[model samples]
Target: MTTLYLLGSAAPPVLEISQVIEDAQGRGYDVCLGLTPSAARWLAPQLAELERLTGHPVRSEYKAPMTADVWPRADVALFAPATFNSINSWAMGFTSSFVVGYAAEAIGKRIPLVAMPCVNAAYAQHRALDRSIAELRGMGVTVLYGPGGFEPNQPGEYRAEGYPWGLALDVVGAMVSPTT
Candidate 1:
């Protein structure tokens, strides 16, 4: 089975990750969940259930050196509902959280990567976001922003139900498809 590292940030859409995981699994992926530290804290109550659903420990922090890995090696990584901070940090190569760290290293490892941001319109206007998106793209990550992916909504008009998990999964499907 292709192991997909389904990573997320603390956006409102992160709350619906269980359904996203199920959707990825249904599409023929062995999903492993990773989240930013803040996202892990936000989903603390459901951590165990998430672990059970993926059959792997949800990771938020870096493990100690020489420690063995808990999840299968990732065949691909999809970071969704990526927040403004997470996007910037990742582009800047600040690997403070396990999710960003793994993603940064994945680029060097040449692992196929995809990301979709969930910034509000106000946050999306920040110059840093554009630079970060471009930087990740330059590094060969398939960042699904703008048309056909998550579009920024008005500040405080956040709707978690509107996140584009299916679109991200579709891209993942193509990446993992044998024909591709």
Candidate 2:
């Protein structure tokens, strides 16, 4: 089974991550979910939903040293609806939380990682965010979505809400496509 890691962020798009996991499972991939603390507050239902869909617990944080071993090796790691905080934290090498920690660990292992950042226009336009994006890119992370041009204000809503199927398909294609 192809192991796909779904990293969460503090945005409404994080809730939609369950749909992505369900779609991936339909395409015959096993999905695992990891959520940021703020993202967990916004979409608590996703934890249960993702567990039901993937038959695995949704990992929120690394509570103990041995906890990391329980996770399967990921074929792909995608951070959808990535928050500005998460982007900055990851870029600055902050791994105090589970999501950032796991991301760092995955990168060290050379896992094929992708991030889809979802932020409002103002946050996206921030100079710090821009620099962080550049740093992440320099670290060889594949950013899967567009630049921060659009804004989606409500929780559980997205500026590009209609394109989830396309996003999920893109993730699947990336996982299976051969690298030169």
Candidate 3:
């Protein structure tokens, strides 16, 4: 099975993560989820349910080095609703959490990485976001942003509209199976 690392950050769309997981599964991917600490807290009520969806525990904190990794090696990675912190931290190689650690590693490990940020318009204007996007793109991570991917919503208000969840999955699908 083609394993996909579905990494989530503390963003508005973390609430709808299960739908994305199911979407990935529908595309024949074996999904593995890792969330930032804050995201984990937000999804606390759904962790067990998420495990059932992926058949693996959702990992947030770093396990001891000696501990066995329950999830398989990822063939590709998707950082959905990737927050401003995650993008900056990942580009700067900050790995305080499991998701960021895995994301940081994916660049060098040469596992295809795709990211879609869900930052608000004001925050998206930060210099760090531009630099981070450029840096990650320079390293071959597929950033789903700009005009097509994630348009920043106004501050204090996320879209009451649905997120384009399938766009990320479509990008990953194309990456994983180009001929398809």
Choose the strongest candidate by lDDT: 1
**lDDT (10s digit) by residue, model 2, range 2-121:** 777878787765656767777777766677888888777777755676678778888787767554565677787877767788888898999878988877777778887877777666
Off by over 4 Å in 1: 159-161, 178-180
Per-candidate clashes, comma-separated: 0, 0, 0
Error in Å for residue 169 of model 2: 4.4
Report the Cα lDDT for candidate 3. 0.90
Displacement of the residue 157 alpha carbon in candidate 1, Å: 0.8
lDDT of 3 by residue, 1-180 (tens): 899999999987889999899988888999999999999999999999999999999999888888999998889999988999999999999888899898888788899999998889899878999999999999999998889888888888856666778999999988996221
lDDT of each: 0.92, 0.72, 0.90
Which residue runs of candidate 2 sit more than 4 Å off their true CA positions? Answer: 145-165, 168-172, 177-180
TM-score of 2: 0.83
- Overall local distance difference test of candidate 2: 0.72
Worst window of 10 by summed lDDT in candidate 3: 171-180
Give lDDT: candidate 2, residue 116. Answer: 70
Residue 19 C-alpha lDDT in model 3? 89
Evaluate candidate 2 by giving its C-alpha RMSD to the native, one decimal: 3.7
